[model samples]
Target: MKKSDINQYGLKPVPDPKGNSTGKAAGKAISRVVITIVSLFFATLFIIGIFMFSYIMSLRGEEIDIDLHSLNLDYTSFIYVNDESGNPVEYKSLYGGESNRIWVDYQDIPQYMKDAMVAIEDKRFWEHNGVDWWRTLGAASNLLSSGGSFGGSTITQQLIKNLTGESDVSISRKLKEIFRAENLEKKYTKEEILECYLNVVNFGSGCKGVQAAANLYFGKDIKDCSLAECAAIAGITQNPYAYSPMNFPDQNKERQQIVLSEMYNQEKITKEEYDQAMSESENMNFVFQEATETGADDTINNWYIDTMIQDVVSDLQSELGYTKEDAQNMIYYGGLKIYSAMDSSAQEMAENAVANDRNLNSDPDMQCGVYMMDYSGRVLAIVGSSDEKEGNMWFNYATDAKRQPGSSFKPIAAYAPAIDKGIINYSSIVQDEPIPNYFDDGTAGPNNYDHQFRGPVTVQYALQQSYNPPAVRVYQQLGPQNAYNFLTQKLGFTSLVGGGVDDSNLGVAIGGVHEGVTVKEMTAAFQIFGNGGQYNEPYTYYYVEDHDGNVILDNRDNISTQAIKSSTATIMQKLLTTVVTQGTGTGAGVTGWQIYGKTGTTDIDDNSYFVGGSPYAVIGVWTGYQNPSRLRNTNASKSVFQSLMGAYLNTKQLKQFTTDSSVTSAVYCTQSGNLAGPGCPTATGWYERSNMPSECTQHQNTNTTSSRSEEEEESSSSNTSSSESSSSSSSSSSSSSSSSSASSSSSSSAA
Candidate 1:
């Protein structure tokens, strides 16, 4: 058969072993089969590459146009005060804004942090360009097996997604992320890409970057992060809320351990370091940054900003017709400049006074609210609690909490109205005897703080001693509806419940309103006396300006209304001054400062108050509990008041309360509410000169003569009764005469 002839199977004959044609032909057959298979494989690969390219291109419509520069970090809006030189001297952030983030450079990042992130997130991070194909395949397998989605995002790909806002979980979105990530890797170095990723990732609880996370979790810089802290932070990238050390410490510890184990298995950390990190992770303590209800960053240890933000939002809504959300956005992102009336020096002093008080510092449940304002009604300093670290309860007790004013409410609710109506003066006598069923509910009427009452006491004596009965008598004389009107309308305390004739009873005189008063309201009410009856509305921020310097709101123009007659305020001031000098509020006295204030303790001692101030400032301090538990001592509020006011007074010059021309000083018999007579005991008092009372009838000429005759007869009879008793009886007569002489000597002592 020919060399190319068919063998038996194909009807062609086989060639000999030495023939080159046979060997060459066999080799060509094998080559043809191999080439065909190779061509088929290349065709399949080309089809897949084309499909992927098309899918990636489909996601490039509007997303590709995003500007990376727009994602840069921004600072939150703040309440700021300028110095004498017109430069920002002090400021505090209005927390819970969108930009509560801080950026850190790649060089400043710790090595352990980078290693842990790479180990847990993408094992082939260094080997791949941007997308880890192996991780993607594994993630796909995990999704299929687990019947749920899984993330395979490399650090660079995450940066692309964050920067471009392509966060949807679709195949097209993944392709877009992969495409953009490759482009990012080409445009920047690996270090730059990693740095941007770290800075833009969310660490939850309103922390938006690694630096903020470091500070919020450890209260330290990113470069100072230990291995365990780094592992914990790295674990948060997977699920920040679920793995938060503050919210879920145990789950966070578990995730942290996984990161440490991965680091050890990958040889990114030594065995000893891995073991130490694992141990520390189990006992990690997180010191979260101070944040508001909205989870925005705030100045550490400064809680006043929370209240300041609330006021800003409300003012914005009322003045500009903006919704709450719109107002917050405007304040946070509109670059508005807030000028606050807060005196930084005074605020620091007030905060320190409360924070450092041993009584306040020792008890966490005991809370204090202090509001200090200047005579112009600008809030100078306010603190909600002694410890700013107290949980997330941002209720600003100074302005938001309605606590009983106790005896502090007396001057506003009772005396001011009584004096304004010419019904009583500081020297006018009021029966101090117990009132019967004053509430009409069979409850006994008010009593003196000492639970003992003198038969008849001057108004000054009653107020100085904080005797509850006198205040209740004055309230009854003024009527409930009238006192409520004076408090709500005249003094701008609109928070008091009920109105008109159906208002609260005599208890209102001692802070027994439906809803009590806030420290801010009480302070403003007291300022009425200091400002000579002019009620200046208490406000914090003076003005706010937008980014373009257009004034959005300006409160520099003072808003003052006449809350009481100047003479009435002067009389009230005189009465309260005696309180500080020789009354229940003597603990608040400062030498040469003419300090005037009142101390108040509620019936059950649940609330205590001291509202007093110098001529330069008015301050109100309250000590109480949220649920109203009796304090260990009623004098607790007094100590806080002394500390705060003393610190404030030390910074100012001595000033005195201005006297009104309509007011005149006089001597009157406290027993009869009449002018001083020859035999009547007298007390110095303030009265409207035109409204002075009549001469004393309790010690008229005939009665005085009769009383003297009776006393003389009695003395003679006692002396004649017994010689042995005569020496003792003569001593008694001399004592009686000395007492009468002493009673006639002074005019201003308490009767």
Candidate 2:
């Protein structure tokens, strides 16, 4: 009944003749090939596949979890802020910490709020099952081009990532996310997926989700958010830190507009509604509540130490592969030996300075923020209050408060960048006259504080007296891009508002910044001036160790970026000394200390600043009110700084500032701020030795009589002679003091 037909091709095999055996026999031998060889090749492939599959399987973690419950984080971990002797000392313990997340049900979330998020996050969210394959393929292509970076992940995929808290940049991890997202979509409805995603997305400022973010940013629950506020909240999920509403308002406003535009383009809202939302957003004022307290119980940690705890948790999540929850858990249970960057001797001095604030400012409401760091960029001490700290984990003014720098920012944003770029130098002549079109409306130039312009002054003299016009002129020459880069990128100023908020305006050089600068950032920024031009990012911790003494996170001296030339730093260092000795910062000087610094006072006189550097440490002090008002005690910051530095320096063996061989002193005309030629009324100034100033062209061959007459004309409105006399007197008695306290107070009065 069965029929066999193996020879379907109609080929017949027969014995070959001896002559044809070489050709026909070999060709026909292909028919006699065995299965063993075929199996061997496939077997090798199978084995390799098994190895790969096993490796991928190894990388797979626990089943995808979207749970909203808190973790079991226990045990006490020791925190260290450097001791009074400048060594790591135990700060306090970490118990169980409270969570900021408070889950709201899916029904409670407003329809427009949901629309805003879906519009900005995923336009095709409702139509897609899980992965958007077209976009996925484009992302894959980009991934290949970018060499392992995975971009354009869908909302479903983002949810999978958020649930797993895994950011491994590998093909296996991406595939795992894709598979989990597909599974999740298959098991749950789109509403469920959206609910889970909304609840888990991080909105920065310690907010876990929309609910927490609404409470933190708006001082209300998510259900109570206005249409404009909802759009603002939706915008923050992309880049939380840069778009933080309270910290950097101008940047956040731009991001909010993008989100609103996305909603309109997607037909999620009508034109009329969009216009109304945009209008409301334009005038919206965020009711920013102070993140003043944490839920840690029975804590002795100050604001600085509290910041250290937060930093440790962050580093664990980044440097190690812990999630935020896991990192927090490890902070309590991982038995870690965390070391902070604080120097205790400086901390004690800072604390004492704040405690004795009554001596400087009579008003108890006048709060001060102080940041002190060594030349190597180790944050020595940070004080955020004038009164003794009351509650646990209160708001940190030293690091968090963004206030205008006024003239104190001159060295960092204006002169230092100019000097580094060779646009201006220590003794370069700059006119204190009006710069054309200085204001945005092009009305007039920056005026001197005393309402009198001193024509043609040295850079040293201009900075010494904190003149606004010269600083703005120098900033114009150097340009805003240079200063912005130097401040934000090189110096690690994270709070500067970018993206055309008039950051390019000449007013910024005179400290008219919109959001302004922080004391912590300013202190770290000044490290380059005293330490040969390398800018070290300010860090809270040094290194972390596990219970067994194994180094887990080493944060010791991150490779410093060379921001400016060492010669420029050395020259600036000497120029700063003039500010303390002969300039407006005279109140900040301590006897026998190589004190160098600049003073800043706001136009409204609400903020006062004195940022100074000694041989060993650089410190910044800001004195203002909680709700800024006209502060009459303008010298409070300088006085507080003097008291602290006097006590701190008296305890340590003194050291001189590091100088480069390329730095040398020159006699410059106080009227010209240039190399003194014949008949020039000159004063001692510092310059970069390699690029020393040319002799004054205006005064080179002038007769003595005319030179004297010209000097009188310039000096009538300026204090050049008096400044030199005070400088000479201060520099002479600088080394004759037995104690810095007595000498500083006596010299402070004299100056």
- Model 1 CA deviation exceeding 4 Å by range: 1-78, 84-99, 102-298, 361-364, 388-393, 498-503, 702-751
Give the 10-residue window scoring lowest on summed lDDT in candidate 1. Answer: 724-733
**lDDT for each residue of candidate 1 in 1-751, tens digit (9 for 90 to 100):** 7545446556546756689888899999999999999999999999999987786567544234444445533235556886656676547654324446666778899999888888998777787888888878887888789965557878887676555433345666666777777766666677776777787776654456778788878888889999999998989877665676755678888999999999999999998998888788767878875433224334442445555556777888888766453465555445678887777788888888888877776667888898999888788888887656532224567777887676778888889888899888877778877666443334444544445567677787777766666777887788776887788788888776443222345556666654567888898889988888899988888888876788888888978999889998888888888777666675667666877888766655667788887888889998878788767655656677778778878877776788999888887775676777766766677888898888887776644522323223223433222110000000011110111110111011010
Error of 2 at 216 (Å): 19
Q: Model 2, residue 301: what's the lDDT?
A: 56
Model 2, residue pairs in steric clash: 83-344, 458-673
Give each model's whole-structure lDDT: 0.70, 0.71
Candidate 2 has what TM-score? 0.62
- TM per model? 0.62, 0.62
Per-residue lDDT of model 2, residues 572-689, tens digit only: 8888887787677766799988998877776657777888888887889988888977675777888888988888889889888878888888777666666777887767777777
Cα error of candidate 2 at position 459, Å? 1.4
